[model samples]
Target: MSHHIVEVKDLHYTYPDGTAALGGVGFRITHGESVALIGANGAGKSTLLLHLNGCLIPEAGTVRMGDFPLTKKTLPHVRQTVGMVFQDPDDQLFMPTVYDDVAFGPLNLGLPPDEIEDRVMEALATVGAAHLRNRPPYRLSGGEKRAVAIASVLSMGPSILIMDEPSSNLDPKARRQLIHLLKSFEHTMIIATHDLDMVLDVCGRTMILKGGHIAADGPTEEILQNEPLLHACSLEKPLRLQGCPVCNPVRA
Candidate 1:
């Protein structure tokens, strides 16, 4: 499964506006690992994710997806191997109908009509969105739209799944459903989100970014439970790990 491994060494990037996004960030994610990237806003989580799929090339350093280095020549193959789901479902659901949106990637790959149909159906089914295939994307709820967006990526048959704020805007029930769905996927997943509680449930490892650099990386529970470290990075313990107000009321 070396083809599923993702590695970054001395990764660095800066926007045209002179804003540094990543500062010598480096890590290795082996096949089938579910990892979470958590940090406050402007912490470089999204920037790091974008580089994994060749969305934004690093100004310096190197990114290797599987055995091939990330370059213009290898970009197509890297993109095919790494599937990215943007923070907003609307960004991915531009096609008129859910089916069309899900089939977009496969269609771009030049898949035959019958194979495209099969991939579309299978992808929708995998995300439990098959019943909504005929509906227009704008008509679906936030959770429904998120499902279809994920289906679109799955249709491309990617080995690595990278998601940005996937549970944002979802209701409690929808969020729970999303968590369950994430748990079921066997793909190598890298999720960047502020939902530390959800990370506790879905990811085994966590990396905290601060000021465009990684401040902490370790097992999820261990990293999240470190209150001082989290505080310094503008984070808090996952609510699940905090003492309940009802059980341990504060005295002022």
Candidate 2:
């Protein structure tokens, strides 16, 4: 039997303006599993991500992190357990300085000043953004900003991490750095991204969402290699799978 660390049961959500964002969606993420959330624009990936940490409560259905169900009373602890990274780093990094931004989460937890400092430094180092710590957040490069944003959450020490479009604006080098940094995490990770290559690198499982429902869920390799299924869902084969001289010598 699998030990699920996160569970969403019969989940349903509708935006305030009467847009149905989720319709009876459900899934279980086993402990230490790295899962990919794949879908097209407006497919509700971000909405599902918010539900993971109680950032946006489900209109109907339950979100469970471990033994605890997400509710008003458990939100604080739930947020501590799940740290979210938004699509844009700017949405998360608002402090004037990178050091301050990275320190914010631990500071809010009322951790000792010394511990917060250590965590901040450690997280910066983990993302390879230590040298950029003293600089102002707004002045940093896109990659630097992303690293610091990730560091901010890392400092909080969450065991369940969710990211939305993590590689969206990143250049190749920046994306590589982020992938390496994410690979070092021991957390149960759920990444919502269009970057299929990153999904291949970091996730063992894949879930494809469409029309507010889970359309497919299974082993990552099998799902990703299904070119017809991908095209049906408005996705394409990963670049590596397309016209690879060695692996897929003949493009199907």
Candidate 3:
């Protein structure tokens, strides 16, 4: 049996302005699996991720990381275990240089200076940004900044990675490179994106969020192939890979 790394039960959240973001959303993510969270705008994908890392505490229900539930006492451990990369790399990368940005997490965790340096180098190398370590984040291109942001999360050695719209603003080449990089990671991943093509390429499982609720959850190809269901959720079905047997195989 698969051991779940993240278990969310009856999770609910609302904004400070009284807008309900998640309405009893529930899901389980197994270790080493890459899952896609698909939804239209305002469907609560980002809100759901915030709860996973304790950035936004729920008004009700519970979010568990391993056996520890997300509470004030457990939030620190949960945040270390689950790393989130937001939609905008600029928002996540605020340090002076790429190296400092990547080293920030380990430093906060109180790692030795030498160990933090080692981790920073390894993470930058993993993301193919080793040479940009000394460069300031404000000077890097969109793709380079995104790569550095990913390196920052990876430096912490988290077991699970949660990304929100990773490919939102990248060009075709950059998006392809990002996808390849993500595919190489062994950790469990939950990617929130509207790019069905990305979901098809990088994830085996897909979950659809509609009106702050889980409307569909299953194999990636199966969920993407369901045109009527996608339509009802206000999501667009992929045009190119729709019926291609090689690309859209039956769910096992």
Candidate 4:
């Protein structure tokens, strides 16, 4: 099976404190598609993402990675197919060295030492962190840490990449570099983020979640341009799309 297709059918979930996180969400993402999931806080974006890799089980529905349903029995394979980069780089980078962090996943898979080394190096190279592989992860800058965290996931050889708030806390240059790197990747990507500008640059399709359900899904340009919808969803047009006050001043 290709493992690049992701499908969710009538998924529902709730938190232990009686918060209804996802009422019933469904979506299908085909191979090689870069999709953005955007919503206000408590909209269930994270909840849905957690279900994709079996980190959170559905209370009343199904998640499928390619042809296989995501259950405890298939959790291992699903995790291998779907690589997740958490919101905070610190949450992902726990090993002493960058190389160790990147190698951790492959090591768990019980791959040979040489193969693990190769994967670690290749992943670090892919994220432009090969030069920092010997350094301690905590010593790296925010952008460098982000890169290495991504390298750690890449080493696992996942076909579907799920990233949460990737550009958060990044300076302009680092954010730009991240956009370029994301653009260069061929993996099927699902990014849940508040950065609409990054969404404009990195994703072709956008899905908006509201109150534990999907509110809208369409072309990024179209969805982002809908001021009414964006306002309703507690979002605004990407700064790039908004008219500059200096250029479009109001007249009496």
Candidate 5:
């Protein structure tokens, strides 16, 4: 049997404003797999991610993490297992100091003081941001803030990492650094973003969302190569890589 980490079945969600965020969307993610959720603005990628961590309960259908289903009683457990990183780091990091922000989750879980310290240090190191531990979050640059946000979730030692637009508002250098950090993580990851290049580099599979539903799902290379489908969904086609003639011979 396949070891699946996340499963969503016919999930549907609508906001209080009566906006349908997710419309009968469904998908399953196997343990250790890196998947990307790609879509245009208002495609419901964030809404779908919120369901994974129980931040938004589905009006219909269900979201399951491991063997536990997301419900009122199971939200805490589900959240502990699934760490969510929002598009804007400011929304996630609110503590006065970077250390406190990074240590918040483990502290809330009631870990020992020593253990919390260790977790905070480890998480910061993982994101290459340990040097900024004592600094205030507001003092950091956009990329640094993003790293701090990720460290906060990492402190919880979550098995699955769910990120929404991780590459947004980042410079080229920062974007590359973020990609390197993400690639180093062994945890299962589900990223929702419009960065097709990042998706091709970090994710093996891609799921395109449209009108709150999954419009296409397949291997990253194959899906990105389909120009018509990509254009229809308001997504850009993937860039092709050039190869040396000696390394990649053309067919006769």
Candidate 6:
């Protein structure tokens, strides 16, 4: 009996200009499971991530973090519980310095100064960015900022972490480092990415979103192997699988 830390039901959202972002999308993430959210552009992956932390309220349907509903009254709590790391590290690391960025959440919680300092240092240490605490966000490298952004979320001590395109702008070494860092966390994680290889390495389950709806959801291995499903979503097999005869037996 696994505990579902995050649950979404019949979620629907539309942009102000008339774009239907999420159409009745629903899913549940159990405690400590890493789930990969895969879809093509305009498939509503980012919109759905917004709903997880109550950033975008649905026109219809419901999103719940544990038992707390994502209403106006509970939004702050939901945001705290479901930490979000945006696709661009720059979007999240806007504070003057790394220390302030990481301490922001804890400060909001009104924790004592000593506790905030402890949490900030622990988070930076966790992401191996303690050395950059005094540096401005603009001074850090892309990988360094990514690490700090993650630490900012981690400093809040959230139970679930949801990232949008976390591996988007990293070098090979940085990408590998990010993957290793994510793998070390014990919290439940949902990563929205096109990095099929990262999905294979970091997540056990995969969910495919197509036109604001869930087209497929299952084990990462099985879903990635379904060529038709991948084709429908405008996705391709992982590089490691694309060349492996065992993984891609029917090459045409």
Question: Model 5: which residue pairs collide?
Answer: none
Ranking by TM-score: 1, 4, 6, 2, 3, 5
lDDT value for candidate 2?
A: 0.89
What is the lDDT of every predicted structure here? 0.93, 0.89, 0.90, 0.94, 0.91, 0.91
The segments of candidate 2 whose C-alpha lies over 4 angstroms from its true place after superposition are 1-4, 244-252
Model 5 whole-model lDDT (C-alpha atoms): 0.91
Q: Kindly report which residue stretches of model 3 are placed more than 4 angstroms away from their true locations once superposed.
A: 1-4, 242-252
lDDT of 4 by residue, 91-176 (tens): 99999999999999999999999999999999999999999989999999999999999999999999999999999999999999
Cα lDDT tens digits, model 2, 154-207, are: 999988889988888889999998899888888899999999999999999999
lDDT of 3 by residue, 1-252 (tens): 232388899988889899988999998888888999999899999999899899888889998886678899998888888889988998999999999999999999999999999999999999999999999999999999899999999999988899999998898999999999999999899999988898899999999999899999999989898989999999877756556767678553
Pairing residues by index, what is the TM-score of model 1? Answer: 0.98
Candidate 6 residues 1-111, lDDT tens each?
Answer: 232387889998999999988889988888888999999999999999988887788789988886688899998878788889998888899899999999999999999
lDDT of 5 by residue, 125-225 (tens): 99999999999999999999999999999999998999999999999999999999998888889999988889889999899999999999889889988
**Which sections of candidate 5 miss by over 4 Å?**
1-4, 240-252
Which whole-number lDDT from 0 to 100 does residue 103 have in model 6? 94
User: What overall lDDT, based on C-alpha atoms, would model 3 receive against the true structure?
Assistant: 0.90
Better of 2 and 3 by lDDT: 3
Better of 1 and 4 by lDDT: 4
Can you give the lDDT of residue 136 in candidate 6? Answer: 99
Lowest summed lDDT window (length 10), candidate 4? 243-252
Pick the winner on TM-score between candidates 2 and 5.
2
Off by over 4 Å in 4: 250-252
Structural similarity to truth (TM-score) of each candidate: 0.98, 0.94, 0.93, 0.97, 0.93, 0.95
